[model samples]
Target chain A: MWCQSCREEYEERDAGTCKECYEEASETEEELKREIDDLKSKVAFLRLVSPLDLISTTDLLLHAAGSSSNANPNSSPSTALPCTPAVPAHRAVLISRSPVFKAMLENEMEESRSGIIKIYDVSYDVLRSFVSYLYTAEVLLDEHMACELLILAEKYQVKHLKIFCEKFMTSKVNNENAIGNYAFAHRHNAKQLLEAALSLIMDNMATLTEREEYKELVEKDPRLVVEIYESYLTRQVNTAAKDSTLQP
Target chain B: MWCQSCREEYEERDAGTCKECYEEASETEEELKREIDDLKSKVAFLRLVSPLDLISTTDLLLHAAGSSSNANPNSSPSTALPCTPAVPAHRAVLISRSPVFKAMLENEMEESRSGIIKIYDVSYDVLRSFVSYLYTAEVLLDEHMACELLILAEKYQVKHLKIFCEKFMTSKVNNENAIGNYAFAHRHNAKQLLEAALSLIMDNMATLTEREEYKELVEKDPRLVVEIYESYLTRQVNTAAKDSTLQP
Candidate 1:
């Protein structure tokens, strides 16, 4: 028989759906694609013009308190970083995007009263990207950027951006960075990243004790290292059970 | 053979895809659904807290120019719209959502100076829905609301809301509303609604002359009435051409 989809000869035993089902599935796929296109346009339309693109209308300024600034709001906004500039933003946009910002602004926090916010332990570029994401729900994220943004997203309770960053970081997890990522994930409460990193760590268990990151992790956080070993033991026990059941 | 999708027996002649292709297609559908979920959350996250919910921080007021006010900005804001209250909005949000508002606010226009915009020839309810949509990209639309909002959307050049209203209006086009909707769509430059209305109008051409809307439209705008007849004539010509070719 000929397969309607691939238009190739196939054995009847190897057949999948019937023609009616196939036609219905194709229609469903097309409808789903149309929905996706509609949603994409909606997202684009709903996106606010990023304040980074329009500085003249700004109502607030965000300074990145880099390491050298000692994370002090009292330090000059420009002097906070290695010549890092303050990111101009609108109060309404910041309030709309983050509940933390909403509370800060609406409750008359010092940041709101002063019309400036100082984000500690973030670089100028990351701070800028973070603010840009608030308005646009978009950012071009590398692994490093994803990690940095995830921390900021977490601190601000920006769940959508945190999930986006975690997805990216999970996809980039590998043997080389699994332990470090696993430790970072544990600290940041990233469940998916933790799971992915742990799976990679277990798959490369033979060299887990040898890596410099692993050694550093053991010295700094022995509990997380023990949890990895515990997970590996559980995996072994589950495998043995599956093997025993297959023997029947 | 068994149909994998329906779990029913089918003849080889009715086969669709091979098992491998079926599995791949199922996976693709799942991935598309996951993507849709992600986009939905992104939309939700980006949605602003409607100013109606928290009116204190509002920076601008919009008064609907109801019929009594004669579309005058000088009248008392409340007295303009049958005791309709002004719609509070943030200037930043208004500027971001509409280029017309951006120009009015950014170019030192009178509306910018007064921080009050009086929208002409619209009721208070319609004006409120319009401003709410600007914040949330959402609205509950009945036929009348859809039509009213479409006009407001087009006048303000809110393309997203206009398209949204057009889609709703198009879906509601029927034998009863076709002629009226056609005229409305044509006036608003709503191509999709115009086509849908035109198609419905053609489908009921035998009864078109009897409809009151058809006569009123002919009296109101003879050019649009002539265009509808011309379109119906073109459709007839095309059908006749196809029939003649098929006979060979």
Candidate 2:
């Protein structure tokens, strides 16, 4: 057992009261647990609504309680419940059958001038993934998608989306396109994306230069030079056999 | 005009050759501008589709190109477009109607939640102001809303939302509920919120002991002692005013 007051280790029997000090360690532990539970409840209650929600709710309550004559239409119908009827199957079918939907599904690339959502002159397609995630809460991110989304998120000024995309890209960084992505992120001022991509490239500098593109990429990010030198020695030995076999 | 490369101020007569520099800075500047424009175009192109849209587009492309033999209609169509058109409009209506909106319009509130939308486990009415901001992109967040939103953002694990709320709350820290909010943020392990709230409380501590709740809160976070002592003079004056008023 542990003395709750001082956080000292003690035998189970001696935990009730320290014979040497006569401290109420065991009693304090119970009280601490209760206190912790109380704090947890308070935290939970506070967590249930954000400051925005609290303010809005308070505003809503005040509006509802105020004279109806002065109440606005938006606030007047605030009490009406959301319509919860199931989305009709025919509506779903109609959505799928729509010409615009068919064109999107058919892979006929649409022009930017086509009346569609645009943020900072970015195409609607790029923002589509983020919007989709917001609506359905599902994400299917890949290396290219991750890189593109991070840029889109940054351009749109969606901080949460940018962070999420950066995190996703961080995990997907590999020998394939880490350098290119890092350079692109750096140039575009996608700081988080750049840092993550650089870290990934730096961590795997050994197997990188086997690819010609990676070698060129390494020159721009000079921090990868030390790791490249170390990996070159081992790689030379492995490639020596192939060099001799190819000798005509 | 200034040389873009060397930052040398020069007259138009010195255009062709700079006596100090080897390369013409104008050429470099033009090249850089062209590069910037190209990057902007690329960014714009990438932003057109979102990750979700990209995934669907990729799937559509693969199927259309006859590269993937297992092109199932059900799987492809369902994941294509993520959001409903009416969501943004609904959000706009919600924001225009809220009391927080009224308060903001009347300039009763200062800063407000921007861009980010917060989710909560409370009544939809509670989320009115937040949702409204998402739709109309305008809000006037007060001190109370700021603090409450910090708690809510932390609870929901919305990083960006939490950051914004904490920032707003931190700016409003006077001798009032700063200590209480600080303690609450600390207890809840909202590090950023705690830091911001604590810094505010610590800056004005003298009046802290007047409120038993604030005193207890300060006791829990003893780091605020220095600020509390500094504010003691202000607290004394306020106390004197109360005492003189009571005598009359």
Candidate 3:
């Protein structure tokens, strides 16, 4: 008879014992010792093959699985092994929260420093923004960030990033905020931003009669005044001519 | 007695002539010969002093009367001398109309072989506009001339000229002529012109859909669609926000 739990052989009668059983029991102790030794060897083998203690546990696990498949072509099915733990999400957050990162992000977000942010060799604020974006997938761009990030995008040679920034900044330059936006556009030499600013300024020209504020601007750049007047005159002339032609 | 016309020294009894009638006639002839010599010297002296022979002749006539007291600081008063014949004004006009003078003007106006027409070195056709403006105090700049002259102006660092051209082009950019003006603006990289074109395009965006000719343009630059839609949305959003805020 065989013991199912221990996988050991035994002889059984009414008493479940024999003369050979007594002698075999003494020898069974020695066999048990040998079995314990075999178990120890298996434990040693598992320790050598397992990746839990490796520098990169994920890399070790992948290596071990690949090696095992290569070693046994027709082995019985094996249980899935545990993998290395994933990188913590808070680590990225902690890095972005550093004082250095905060300063760098703040500097990059400032509109006045636009076109001067070089991401690869950038100050701490820009790096923080980049890290934050990567970790959270959240783009925190206000008007200032939108302008600065366009420059950063161009600096980093990221075409899609620049387009996204430009889209955001263009939307911000309305009649109310156009003057400040125009300043940023002029500082960075942003063509699209300038065009948007011009349109907003032109649209609101009639209402921007806070003469003292923009008087010097208009005086210094008389061409701007001339442009507005000429455009107005042109429209009036065209409308009159059109009306006359339509009257017939 | 002295003859006022002759200015000859005379003996009192014989007057200005000899006792014999034949001698008197001879004496008169001698006096006349001496007067002719004095006149010839006077004419030569007058020609040396005056730039214009006609003016010199008039000076001599006036000074010989002894009635004129005016003295020219530029030249000594004519010494009661015979006048010289005036040089014709036709000579000055003839020189001005010469082929050499025309050639010099043409050379000054020709575009440099280097493809740069400095505002200072622009050809007669372009310069004729400036000259005409100077003479008539008019600001009539033809469309084609304005465009070509702008290129010359930009090349020569003439900011005023460029501004003038931009103002002219801006006035011309309307729905009916925007396409041509847009092409010109792009060619010259004229920022003002481009802005004008953009404004015209935006204003006429609805009509553009009706025109089959501009369908390809709208398709090629999808941003055009975004610009129009966003502009409309912005106006709506602002109006809605204002109304909602005011409702309280």
Candidate 4:
């Protein structure tokens, strides 16, 4: 009989679905594609123009803290951050996007009063990308940028950006980076990344002990290393139990 | 043969896709659903908190024009327009979402100077919904609200909101309101709504001339009526030609 979808002859044993079911599947596929298109348009609509792109509309400025030595540390904020150019932002955008920013700006805080929010423990480039992501929900991520932004996202409690960074890191996980990523994920509370990294580490457990990163992890974060071994042992026990049940 | 998908026995003639093709299609469907999920999260992340919802973060005030008494005409913006409570907004959000607002606010315009933008010919509720849609890309749209917002969107060059309102209005097109929607769509340059309304109008041409809306449309805009007739004639000619071609 001819397969309705590809219009090619197939053996009776190689049948997929009945004609009615096939038609229903095709309809469902079409509906799903339509929904994707609608969702894409919504995303485009909802994405606000990054304040950094606008020349003159910024209501707040974010300075990368520790950019340089403050010559006159007691001076006004505008004069204090003398090295790195600030990542200009809007107050409304900041407060709306990050709960950390919301609390910092809404209260009678120094950042709110001065209109110059100094983001600490972050580089100028990463700070800019973080602010831009808040507006557009987009970023060009390499492994390094993803890790940095994930840390910042975690600090600021931006769940969406944290998930985005975690997904990227998870996808980039390999045998070489698995232990390191596993440690990072544990520190950041990234459950998905932790699972992915742990799984990768488990698959190469024979060589894991010899890897330099694994040694470093064992030294720096023995608790995380212990957790990984625990997970591996649990998986092994689960497999052994299943294999034993087959003896019946 | 046993159908792989419903696990039902089927006759040879009722065969659908081959097993390989079925699996590929299933994978494509899963990929599409995953894409939809990603786009949805992007949209959620990009959506800003409406300034109205957050107290004391607003930097701009959008007042619905012609609400009532302007009480103290020359009063400060904080005290001006005593009748209608202004829909508070953020300048950055307004500029990013609408080019019209950007141009009005970025330059040393009157609205920018006073920080009170008077949206003329719009009611308080519609203006509020319009502002809310800019921030969130969402609003509970009914026919009247959609029409009002469509006009506002067009005037402000918010293409996303315009398309959204047009889609809503088009879906609502029917025999009863086809003529009215057609006219509104024409005025607003809403192509989708215009086509939907025009198609409905064409389908009901037998009673078109007798309708009160048709009579009013003819009196108000004879050109639009002429265009409708032209479209109906063109459709009839095309149908006749196609029917004749099929006869062979």
Candidate 5:
């Protein structure tokens, strides 16, 4: 018989779905595509023009603290990184996108009154991207950028960008980085990344201790290492119980 | 054999695709659904809090003209529609959503200088819904609301909202209202609704002239009626040509 989709011949045992089902599936696919197009347009429509361009109405300036600045002299000029410029943003956009910003800007906080926010441990580039994401819901992410933005996203309670960064980082995780990622995930409350890292760590439990990250984790946070061992033991007990049931 | 989707038995002749194809298709569907969910989250994230509550930051006021007010006495007090209080909105949001608004706000237009825009030929409720849609990309619509919003959407060049309203109005088009909808669609430049309404009108051409709307349309705009007949004639000629080609 012919497969309606691929238009290739197939044996009876290899058949997938009937003609009626195939037709229905095709229609469903078309409908889904149309819905996606409509949604893409809606997303485009809803996305704000980045406040980066329109500083006329800006209510706040975010400075990237903990970066090299002209005021700081210990860092030599040639080797020192360029000072990160302050990013301009609107209070209304910030409040809408993040609860952290909402609180900071809405309540009579010092930052709200001063209209200046110092974001520590973030470079100017990352700070700019973070603010841009708040307005546009978009960012170009590499693993390094993803990790940086994930931290900022977590700090500001931008759940959408946090999940987006987490998904990217989780997809890039492997045996070498699983232990480190697992610890990072735990610290940041990234449940999805934590599960992915823990699952990879479990699958290669035989070499768990030999890894440099595992030893560092043991020294840094013994409780986390203990939790890993506890999870391994639980899995072993569940497997043995299943084996016993099969034998009976 | 069992149908994988419905889990029901089917004859050999009813088969559609192979097992591999079915698995691939299911995976594709899952991927598409995941994409849809991601887009939905992005839409939600980008969506602004309704400007109604953010009046502190609003830079403009929109008054719905032709609504109940002392300016027009014919609209009696008891029977009159309640005056639509002026809706406050952000200049940034206005400039982002509609090109007309962007042009008006950016070009130092009178409205921009005054920070008050008078929207002619709209009721207060419809104007409120239109502004809410600009902020949230959402509005509940019945057929009447859909038509009214479509007109506003067109006038403002809010293509996304215009398409959304047109789709809703098109779905509600039928034999009874096709002529009226077609005329409305033409006036609004709603291509999708216009096509849907036109097709329905052509299908019922036999009874077209007898309908009261047909006569009203004839008196109101004979050119649109002529276009409908032209489309009907074109369809008839194509059908006859296809039939003659099949005879050989």
Candidate 6:
């Protein structure tokens, strides 16, 4: 018979859905597309003009605290990376986006009073991207940038950015980086990334001890390495129980 | 053959799609749904805490100008309707959401200087809902509220909110209210709502002149009524052209 969709002939065993169901599915798809278009427009509307564009409204300056003396290649020798021009942002926007910022700004903290926030352990570029993400909910991220932003997102309790970075990292997870990613995820409480990385590690358990990351993790945090073994043992027991049930 | 979607047996002629096409479509649907979920989360993240919740951060106050003097049933006698509390808002949010507000605030306008904007001809409830929508991109709307907000949205040049209101009003349009909605939509420059209402009006051309709204519309805006007749005439011409071609 001729298929309504794709206009192809299919054998009886290769048939998918009935004509009524196909029509219903098409309607559902159209409705879903309409909803997506509406949401995209909303996202565009809600997006604030990046503080980078308009400095007049900025109420706070964020400095990358530890980057000044790094002598980074991204910075010129004369500029001394530390004074890399601070990212300007609005207090209201910061407060709305991050609970850490809200509490710090709302209280009589030095940063609140001085209108300057020093973000520790972040490079100037990363800090700029992080602050930009707060305003626009967007960032062009590589794996390194994703990991860096994930740490910042976690530290500031920006759940949305954290999830975004975690998802990116999770997608990039593989056999080689699984151990390292698993360790990073554990440290940052990235459950999704942790699960993805751990699943990859478990799938290649035969080579688990051969990886340098696994050895480094074992040395750095023996407890994390033990947890991996525990999970592997549990998975083995579960599989064995399932196999026994099937035999019975 | 058994239909995969509904698990129902179907005749040979009732087939919808081949298995490969069905699987691909299902995957596409899943991907679309995931995209929608991501967009929804982004919207939620970008949405600000309503200005009413945090007045300390608010830099502007909006008054319902004509509402205070109206001693309508909606307001209590003791309050005299004039003392309706002003809706507090943030200038950054207002500017980002509406071009009218952006220009007014960015310039040295009286409202910008005074930190107070008086929205003309809107009730206290509608004004509050309007400001709330500015922050959250959401509103609980009935027909009356939708119309009121649509007018305010148009006045303020909040295109997102205006489109939202227009979509709501367009969905509610029918033969009974088509004439009134058409007039309202035309005034607000709501093209979608106008077209929907006009289409309904044209479809019921036989009963158009008999309706009380038709008489009211003719009395109120004879030009709009004339346009409706013009559209009907054009439709008749196009139908005749098509019919004549088919006959040949």
CAPRI-wise, candidate 1 is medium
lDDT tens digits, residue span A1-248, model 3: 43322334433311122223323444544555554544333222111111121122111011112122343232235733212222211211211223332243345454113312222323344444543332222367887666666665564444444655776899777776766566556666676877787677767777765744356547666555565567657766988999999995
Considering only N, C-alpha and C atoms within 3 Å, which residue pairs clash in candidate 6? A68-A82, B68-B82
Which 10-residue window of candidate 1 chain A scores lowest in summed lDDT? A67-76
Root-mean-square deviation (CA) per prediction: 2.7, 26.5, 54.3, 3.7, 4.2, 4.3
Name model 3 segments beyond 4 Å from true.
A1-123, A130-138, A155-157, A186-192, A209-213, A216-246, B1-248
> Model 5: which residue pairs collide?
A16-B17, A16-B18, A17-B16, A18-B16
**Residue ranges of candidate 2 with Cα displaced over 4 Å:** A1-126, A133-140, A175-177, A203-208, A216-248, B1-92, B95-248
Q: Residue B122 error for model 2, in Å?
A: 23
Best candidate, DockQ: 4
Off by over 4 Å in 5: A67-83, B67-83
TM-score-wise, the better of 1 and 2 is 1
Chain B alone, candidate 6, TM-score of: 0.91
DockQ of 5: 0.67
Residue B214, model 5, lDDT = 94
lDDT of 5 by residue, B156-245 (tens): 999888989988998999999999999998898888899999999988878888999999999999999999989899999999999999
lDDT for model 4 comes to 0.87
lDDT of each: 0.87, 0.43, 0.44, 0.87, 0.87, 0.88
For candidate 1 chain B, the 10 contiguous residues with the lowest summed lDDT are B66-75
Candidate number achieving the greatest lDDT relative to the actual structure: 6
Cα lDDT tens digits for candidate 1, A98-206? 8898899888689889888878888888998999899989999999999999999999988889999999999999989999999999999999999999999999999
Reference-based TM-score of each model:
0.94, 0.27, 0.23, 0.92, 0.91, 0.90
Interface C-alpha RMSD after superposing true interface residues, each candidate, one decimal:
1.4, 30.5, 79.7, 1.3, 1.0, 1.1
The local distance difference test score of model 6 is 0.88
Clashes of each: 0, 21, 5, 0, 4, 2
Interface RMSD of 6: 1.1
